[model samples]
Target: MKKYCFGVDVGGTTVKVGLFTVEGQLLDKWEIITRTENNGENILFDICESLEAKLDEKSIDLDEVKGIGIGLPGPVLDDGTVLQCVNLGWGKFNVSEKMSEMFHGIEVKAGNDANVAALGEAWKGGGKNFDDIVMVTLGTGVGGGVILEGKILTGHNGAAGEIGHMHVEDGEELNCNCGGCGCLEQYASATGVVRLANRYIAKNSESTKMTEFGEDITAKDVFDLAKEGDKGAVAVVEQMSTYLGKAMASIATVVNPQAFIIGGGVSKAGQYLIDAIADVYVKYAFPACREAKIALAELGNDAGIYGAAALIV
Candidate 1:
């Protein structure tokens, strides 16, 4: 009987690898550098070497390993074909097939990083109790994943849960990294919060504490001030919550997830942020969807590995 499995989350700078029991308990975890040189040709080789070393160190035989699940920073089709991953210098290819070949016929599964993270949450994190959930990661940029009936929903092109690029405003001059204007990522992400704070400070000469941080102001600072009842900071936080909540409400109408799990660096704001966004979410959400729970992700950074393992475990 298979007793173990491996989870690999490939990011731009590093790859997080986790070894787990067939029963879902993590046995070991580590990280390896992601060599993006030569179009990331060495990425798989590096991961394979790392896993081999790990297995050898643990004295685990290949016969006892079940499978390997990998999450990539790009759109990944159901068959494990990655359309593109510019950050990793990767192009269209069957990642699962390649990795399986490198692993000498071991089973391998693949998925988009964000979606796999959501799957991890659904399987072992905040949304584990719920059958359907939408996970929003408010980091440098907004990332999202949808889990329906406990399955990752990777739309026709593997871009199903890209809630960050959902248009939230009109007539905006600035373009998001995705080449879109007024996207949710532009106003709801960590940088988006800073942008809102800066825009507010620039427009209204408010004698607020935010100015103390000056140009280095971050999303955490904004939230801290907002929690302290600073008017300008409150406005900025409210605006961001409004955009995020409204976008989630729109998503509710379509997927009607049972919950929205907020994760990432920004989620460190804690329950206060959840309450603030929940207030706006209720107002904008359909009456039937208003009951959806808004909670913080419990898995933190581990969600990616857990979700990746879920692909095959």
Candidate 2:
């Protein structure tokens, strides 16, 4: 009989699940809408239903499954408790325990989504060659995961890699959802990029091509405009890149990881964003830490799914 494991990545909009062989090949995959309206119970129900369907379709017996791993967008307690996912409307839920009960005798494991992404990158993406790496996801919000000596470092409170919450500017006063001000995430994420662009448009409307797109625009629009030599768009990209580089330099000074693996939607900006950030990172980074490499994520959207599978192995 063949052996397999189930890996699930839970996001606000969708839950992606994959079945993988022990050797890391993804045999099959599926996705379902993540319904957070029912306090996450609905999401769990959706996962169970989808997995059963996939098993039936593949003619796979439950007995051949080794275990189930999940990546959640919240801090998972040491004993598998999910503590308040702001995006999912779940708080203090025994995620692993509940899933184990739902799956009968199968083992269930869970971790923070960012940590899982890091593990995924280490297992199959850009950081595969390096045992020590920091994975940063640049999306609506900044998320991060740290790997040291081939192990995920969750710190004492399971917030070890919450580098996004680190303060970037003292007394500068940028509001953050975490109730803090001047967090790195506030200035280095896609949302941040949009905010900066909007501010630039408000102050210097004449310099932007964004005015042509009307009142509402996005970070991608800014990048597109910059590609067309829009002055305001170029300025926004430069500012965003500088802040991101400064944040990375701070991370390097402390963690000194072998590589900083950049992932998420914003990373799609590719070499343009990479080169811009690198210019500032090398300037501010400690001499020893400046040697660390900055690389684009290779796995794209499938990273979380593959990383969840890695946890079970």
Candidate 3:
């Protein structure tokens, strides 16, 4: 390992960049617009150029940097090959190799964004001080990363921690983007909470403060109303928590992590969401693993950069 490193997180809208000490301390961070035009041919070029400018601005030479670690918003094979990333207009290619070549053989490592985020939490966020932990990102869709013995379990197809796609509701008919039905993502994600609340009011004709929000209802709305003792909203929150907890429990039977770190926009609900999920997790968790703690992720948007830096750390 070297003394300094560069961490880059590629997203659809922008690319997040970070300068870090090999000791795992972030020194500085910044972002640049991601031009997805022309098949995103400029994406890597932009990142490389941005690094050059950043290094020059800091009066640092490229020789001082150990390597570049990047997290991509897509499935990344063990060889750092990206299958595809619709948001970034990326297709199949060995990202690590290409990046290393662009950087004049300094070094480069790449991984799935969610998995890297898990590595981030494990390294310096909520999962810090624990060697085995899993990170669940509850965004528009659910994303997961499993870390055991302080390493990510990328799995045979680089899809081990696809916890959102885990089968939870077998009877549901809605298809997940992954071409599956009754996925945990459908009921456990932020969008799932709103969908559940709407379903409850529709199926039971229950009066909820939620109805007042109409099309404006959100997962936060459901949790807020639930906290205020709204029956319909509480039920919806509980339902989402139940499925989420159950999914975690099932995950434990395999990886048996010491803790679960919850992140993403929905996690803003804080303790309320963690407690709700933990309540149901106990029922489904293996006896030995039932005590696994659920906690909020400490790193937010910065998690990607932190985890990316960790790849080279």
Candidate 4:
């Protein structure tokens, strides 16, 4: 007898859905525009309808499907309750129960999107072969997910891997969008890189491509210039790595994963980024844990879908 599963990654713009065999082979995947109007009321219905259509198109029996796994853009409790999804316009609610009811009692498991992505990486990406993994996603904002011994540490409120909010600096009183000061996100995210670059530019009018890009500069541009040995961009990347390395070092003390898998858009900078971060991590890490590895995530956008699908298994 063959088995199948469905994975859903609910995002602000679109909901990614994947169909996979129970053995972790992805059969098909598609996307649907997330209708977030009216507090995301249509999101769940949209997912179920999409899955139903896929099943009909594939001529697959509903009984052969084990369950549906979903990764939401918010904190999800073990009971499938979502505390809130700011991007999806959702308030506190039980996502798993509603999804299960929508799918006619099919088992539904839910988790935070970043956490789910971490699980995907652990299973098949950079963290493969390592049961304990910590994933840091450096996109528009920094996100983190922790998987220890093949299990996600969701914490009491499902906020265990929220590494972006870690307070790294003490004198930064301007406050972050999360209403905190000196957060790791403020210094290590894509936007954060631009901020660091501008400060460096202001301090020294160095001849580099980063300064030429003006305020429109991006993290990629900085890294690109750094790869060419540009002094200013190298400084910016070094600074960003400093904060991220320190944060990961602190995380290593508790989560103590075998590897720190770096993902997200910023990670596109490639090996130099990993080298920079690893250099600083080694300096701040506990003496006994200095050997923990740092590597880039293999799956790009598909990690969340794979992870959400894994939730059912």
Candidate 5:
């Protein structure tokens, strides 16, 4: 009987790999630099090589491994076909098919990185107590994933949780990376916080601590200043929280998840951030969904690997 499995989280700069027992206990983990040269053609081969090396080091036979699960930084169809991963310089292709071939028919599963992370959180992280949840990642961009009854809700064409692109503003002058204006990501992401802070600083004539950093301000700086009672910083946080809370309330009317799991870099602001969003969420949420709990993600960076492993577990 198979006793082990592997998980891989592919990113632009590196690949995170983990070895886990079939029961979902992680045994070891490591990382490898991502060589994106040649349109990332070597990426898969490199991951395979790393996996093989890991097996050898652990003295485990190929027959003892059940399968491998992978998470990629782009939309992935239910059938494991990656529509297109621009950051990886990859075009449409079957990730499961190619990896299975390389492993001589071993089972392989693939999913969008954000979705997989949500699955991981449901399985063992912040949302472990609930079977239904929405995970929002607030990093360079805002990403989201939904889980229902412990399974990922991969929508048609595998784009169910692109929450960042939800139109949140009426007249945004700047465009989001997705090419839309006034997206939730534009005001809720870490970069988005900086943008808001800058705009607030530009218009407010009041003295504040944010100006101490001048042009080198950051999301953390804004949150820190807010915690320290800086009016300008507090205003920026309030604006960001308003957009996020409103978007989440709209989502609740549709999915009505048991909980909303907040993750990614900006979430590091901790309970203050959660409280801010939760306060706004209740104002707009449907009466039936008003009790949905908002909580912080527990897995941190390791969430991706854990989620990938869950694909096969």
Candidate 6:
């Protein structure tokens, strides 16, 4: 007689699923590889099969499931159609409709991954106490989510919290996957950090600890070297922080959320990254906005599933 819901976070390489109680307690979780080669339709079949196996193994009845929520990597239209998923090669698919059919009429809700992550943080992670929060994921590319008055803010085109695509530099061309240049993502994301580091090394080859790693270095390697007091690494970190802070400042001017929660792999850089970025963020922000609290995301990699669960809760 216990009520439960399933939260599915669909990524390019993996699909993470979490079983949660109606009250938001995560009871069990699992993941499966997402095979997109057979077309997007096969992905749903694999997920349905995986979910059935997991539920059977746990002796959970399908009747007890209240709903299924999904967090997708691309933009979802207002009418429950997915516009496109560049990573998944899915375009204009009816995700929610397909999911409901797969689950035999169970209720289903779908949203962008960043928005779900923000909702997850608001429900149980870093933004637990605040009704207004902005969550930023600084990974391969930057992604953002906005929660206002306890609701996810999806704009007219369902692309509301796309802070990464915000233009930071005017008339300065830098290639972005969104087909634009000078995007904030190009400077503030982990990919951006590596790009900046590589550029620095290309120009200052003899003056950097990056020279030790040859041509193939990563953002983590840069952070490690920075911790070791490498001058070049330190410079890269500072520059990265400056750009990140600048982006935060711009975000603050618009949304002015109560808190900014930073997540994703790069966030593991810890206080070194946070403190440095905050130092510059305060300098660039407006008087009242500068007081906004900055914090690290508590959920780690599981944030997506938790966030998806939040949609139902």
Clashes of each: 1, 0, 0, 0, 0, 0
Cα lDDT of model 4 by residue, 1-313, tens digit = 4499998898999999999998888999999999999988898998899999999999999899999989999899998999999999999999999989889898999999999999989988899978799999999999999998877889997889999999999978678988999999998999999999988998887566677898899999999999999999999999999999999999999978899999999999999999999999999999977899999999899999999988887
Candidate 6: what lDDT? Answer: 0.85
| TM-scores for every predicted model | 0.99, 0.93, 0.97, 0.98, 0.98, 0.94
lDDT of 5 by residue, 76-123 (tens): 998899999988999999999999998878999999999999998988
Q: Cα RMSD to native, each candidate?
A: 0.8, 1.9, 1.2, 1.0, 0.9, 1.7
Give candidate 4 regions above 4 Å deviation.
Answer: none
* Model 4 poorest ten-residue lDDT run: 202-211
TM-score of 2: 0.93
In the range 1-313, model 6's lDDT, one tens digit per residue, is 5488888999999999999998889999999998888456678888889888888998889898888888999887655678888777788878888889988888788889988888898888988888799998889898999989767888888899998898877755668988989887887788887887888888888987898887678788888889888888899899888877888888889989899888888888888888888999999998989988888899887888888887776
**By descending TM-score, how would the candidates be arranged?**
1, 5, 4, 3, 6, 2
The most accurate candidate by lDDT is 1
Which residue pairs overlap in candidate 6's backbone? none
Evaluation by lDDT, superior candidate among 3 and 4: 4
What does candidate 1 score on TM?
A: 0.99
Which residue pairs in model 5 clash with each other?
A: none
Candidate 6 ranges beyond 4 A from true positions: 170-173
Residue 45 of model 5 has an lDDT of 93
Instruction: Provide the clash count, candidate 2.
Output: 0
Specify the poorest-scoring 10-residue window by lDDT in model 2: 166-175
Residue 125, candidate 2: C-alpha displacement in angstroms: 1.5
Residue by residue across 149-196, what tens digits does model 1's lDDT show? 878999999999999999999967899999989999999899999999
Candidate with the larger lDDT of 1 and 6: 1
> Model 4 lDDT vs. the true structure?
0.92
